[model samples]
Target: MSDDVTAAADAVRHGEVVVYPTETVYGMGADATNPDAVERVFDTKGRDRDKPLSAGFPSVDAALEYVVTTDLEVAFMRRFLPGPVTVVVERRDALPDVLVAGRDRVGVRVPDHDLACDFFERADTPVTATSANRSGTGSITNPSQLSDDVREAVAVVLDGGTTPGTESTVVDPGRGIIHRRGAMADDIETWLAEHADSEPDA
Candidate 1:
């Protein structure tokens, strides 16, 4: 497992796409900061070029570095992140257009899984957090769940066993919006209500 993680990190560093496990599901990623590498992810997943890709960071602080946030939101991140929520916030220009899709906002994640984040940290780059599946298909939870096309498209698949099968709940705290409700919606709502100065718009 350790050797595989090392190889995966190396692969990412060299601009190769790799399939890795996240707490929510398996993700097909490459260095999010690398435009060519990020393009590979979009190509592999058959993802829409205009659709933005979320980023997975090694830690909460690292993830926060790419987005605009307030103290209350940072507290929310500290509390629920490294878990199963993707926080959407104002994007920083440091992120490439491929990841942000020319938008001013981007979704960010700090995966709770140790192996995945270790790979990200070792690679020393943020990774695209899009699911390892063809567009419009269900996410891959295990290697066997990968389609033939998807299986053939990647250079490595780090089988971290079966994932939790629920995609992360996506929230835009600045707008008080829940973009997608999944594994952690209720908990996030409660936390936001307790911490946010005003209620979320949605």
Candidate 2:
């Protein structure tokens, strides 16, 4: 890996936060198991430490390894991944309370972007994910366009050209709540609908 990628991955390994690209938007990330590292994210974003954040993995199985993944979680992972969709599933003891915001479940995703996928390869563990921007604001889709404050604040930035400029569609598969109107095309949605039916309930 180049020095920049190595440094970014090292930051994560050391429990520091790093800003990186995902197909949907720029995301700030930390080692999913490190509560203190996770705390730094909230402090940096001035985020409500109480608000739960989701995690992104390279693949469904990768995510399942970190948490107390259920059949529904695994089913949903099989159903919608390498696409812009998030799933909420039961949390495991390994996750910190702050990451889940005192909630019983945690969100998980597998972004369709290559650079983001590399995180799973680099960290060899799950990484909590949230948009780089503050709460209630539009997600930053283009890393190149990020303000200096946002850019400089992060330990490293991986340029992934202009992203699709849309955030991932979220779904609470655990509760059967279709939380987000995902950004994929109709064909993909139709595929999701079809696959969802075939999968057994959690």
Candidate 3:
């Protein structure tokens, strides 16, 4: 691993936040299971406490450790994960309530970026997967665009050049709902419609 990636991972394990690149955009990361670390993310971004943050893992299999997934959800993950998509599913007790905002469900992200996955794997835990920007502000595509507040709040910044800058599509496959339409919306919608019959009754 590169020195920057290793530092970022170490910061996360030490309950500090870091900024890292993702396939969609730059993301603010902290140990998702740590309530204090998660609170720091919300505070740093001035984000509403009720607004839940997604947890990022190195892979779908790693994410499965923190979320409860049905067969349909598993199929959906297999089809679109390691891409720009946030799959919402039930959270395991291992996740802090702060991360999910006291909600039963949480968003799971497996970014299709080598740096991100490497950081997650080295961190050895799920990390907060929210954009690396203050709430209500634009998402960041490059480390150069990161605000002073965000930069100062984070312990490390892993610059992986520029990112695609699009937000990931957020969907609840079990409920067959698309909470937010973003990258690959059309393809995701098509997949959902074609697999609607397989979704568990809501």
**TM-score, model 3 to reference:** 0.98
Locate the minimum summed-lDDT window of 10 residues in model 2: 184-193
Q: Native-vs-model 1 lDDT?
A: 0.86
lDDT of 3 by residue, 1-202 (tens): 3998889999999999999999999999999999999999999999999999999999999999888989999999999999999999999999999998999999999999999999999999999999999999999999999999999999999989999888999999999999999999999999999999976644
lDDT: which is higher, 1 or 3? 3
Best by lDDT: 3
Candidates' C-alpha lDDT: 0.86, 0.76, 0.94
In candidate 3, how many clashes are counted?
A: 0
Candidate 2 collision pairs: none
Per-residue alpha-carbon lDDT of candidate 1 for residues 53-160, written as tens digits (9 for 90 to 100): 999899988987777876656776788889889988777777898788898888888999998899888888888888999999988888899989888878888999
lDDT of 2 by residue, 4-53 (tens): 66778888888888888887888888887888988878876778977888
**Candidate numbers, best lDDT first, in rank order:** 3, 1, 2
Q: Residue 37 of model 1: what lDDT? A: 95
Q: What is the RMSD, in Å, between candidate 1 and the native fold over all Cα?
A: 1.9
